[model samples]
Target: MASDIIIVGQGICGSLLSWSLLQKGISVKVYDIDADHSATAAASGIINPITGKRFVKSWMVDELFPAADKTYSEISQAIGVHFYEKLPIYKLLESVKEQNDLSARATETGYEQYFTNTDVQYLDKGKVKNEFGSFVINGGGKMDTQLFINSYRTFLKNKGILIEEPFTYEQALVSKSKVIFCNGYKAAQTGFFRDLTWQIVKGEYLLVRIKDFYADRIISGDTTISPTSEKDIYYAGATYQWHYETEAPTEQYKNEIIESLNKMLHVPFEVVYHGAGIRPSAKYRRPFIGFHPEYKHVGIFNGMGTKGISLSPYFAEHFAEHIVNGKELLPEVDVKNILIKS
Candidate 1:
């Protein structure tokens, strides 16, 4: 019933935070309402070092990428699952303007270390349309989020730390030294972050079976495709919608993604599965971290948005350190500095 830390969500954020806390010899009690369609489950977990349009380096690629790789690798070994893989992303450009903009931006940002204007003539001869595009092969890859969560959950359960049910918010107790909320989105309904703008977007993706286009690398364009190594099975997805009826997959999104895929590839494929989840994106797109102003013990580690895979590890360690050792939080990402005043 009591723990040094009570985490109310077993998604990537909560899972990683729990792991970090346990590593520091802290007792963590994690509560979750089983898995729902959320970014962690639906995420392709791609950690691109460069942004798509700007081709600029990610916010903290030099640091975050290495830390993420090391963390995932260590955790994967401990849990006996392949959780991380380094893959080069082949970005397909559709128009001359996009190509030009990419080139100019790369030059301006000195992103040539990753970006190059290569003759993708081989791809041009394929059935798909190609207006000629540049390639930016950066050091980034994907995380098997679902596998990681399930494996970690099992690990925690074996260690007698996981509670596989929804935590009742009414049970949460907030005191001067500690505060707890039920889950990430549930915090919104609790009115804790009423002043903070939450831009919850629903995203959907489909699994497809396609033969002969197998590659260890990840392909990103209008629609991204990740090869799963299962013959003729690949993860192709993802449509982002600002407004949606529910967090369930829709035929409208499936058709749109499939149509987009048809435009990029010449091969035939069969639709296998569809998944949808709502991402807890913030208005400013930075993660929401810190304790409540009025409630000193209440803290949050949510809002990594789509970058949860890359962001969670570093921030989790940072947060755990802050909690355990009285260390100073990072200036840019410290939650206390970013909290919206009520």
Candidate 2:
């Protein structure tokens, strides 16, 4: 019997989407070449409740956070690998204006959840530079992207549903089951969804080992410093380049991250790894989740951008519902609506 669906690309998006469908008793065959430096692997996996220069809550944080927490927890138990961690974010204030802005924003009605206590002072002056003080943000955490993806891939392989190879559109055309492309920025280069407005971004980061510096929480300064599953090794990043010549990691970006680390850390650190990945940001900064307008069987669940870690699980379940039951897709995320607006 033919599988219910064929998922192309086994990144976080693809992994979660297939898992969601499988949990609903739908059979799925996943195709992926497993590139060495994909976007999912390079992600810092930091889920901040607030974002941007204005320090406003992230887009859809209220719904996204709860869904992410529940889904990651469920998947962790299913796979027996603890990958999701709820940790506070220590945001170092860059200037007095920033401190004042946050102080004022904290008094607002809805902002109190993330900024309940801004009086937390930056105490480790000897270890970290704190010329302007900082605050601890609640409802922020990190996901072990590598562990989750790798272990889940293994789980799929054990089930004999994962096919390790390049999947082309021609194969998708001939497939008996519905095919959804979960490929990253590469989707913009080829396939039916190429015409859709794509704001492809290239992000680069560094993996560093800082001796004698212990951080149980995520540190957000000029660059975000997130802990990994490994001891003493942290993921520091990242430089966002809206226009870049290549997806490969450049020395210039590596030095740029090092400079930011120097500004925040008083201690010396060694660069263990440098990586880069291309993000598939949509025109309106939303995801594309639905079937194509013309070719109904060919669908997409890409364009999660930097928020793939938090967005995937929620959206995956949503897309699965749309596929399983006759649920209406949100106008913002519905590809038909998005393409019509564009």
RMSD of 2: 1.4
As for candidate 2, its clashing pairs are: none
**Candidate 1 structure lDDT:** 0.73
Top TM-score hit? 2
Tens-digit per-residue lDDT, 1-342, candidate 1: 244678778888888888888889988788777654446878877888777566677777677777788878888887888977888777777777767766676665556655554334234335344557536566778877677777888888888988877665445543322434425555555646545566777789888987777467777778888876367777887677888887789999999999988887877889988888778777777777766676566778887777788888888888888988988877656556666432
Q: Candidate 2, which segments miss by more than 4 Å at Cα?
A: none
Top model number, lDDT: 2
Expressed as tens digits, the lDDT of each residue in 1-342 for candidate 2 is 265699998888899999899999999999889744568877888899888899888888989899999998998999899988999888889888988888888788987778768684774898889888888788878988777778888899999999999889888777777999999888999987887878999999999998767558888899989888888898999888999987789999999999999989998899999999888888778898999887788899999987898888889999999999968888889998876666
- Which stretches in model 1 have alpha-carbon errors above 4 Å? 1-3, 100-124, 174-182, 340-342
RMSD list, candidates in order: 2.7, 1.4
User: What's the TM-score of every candidate structure?
Assistant: 0.90, 0.96
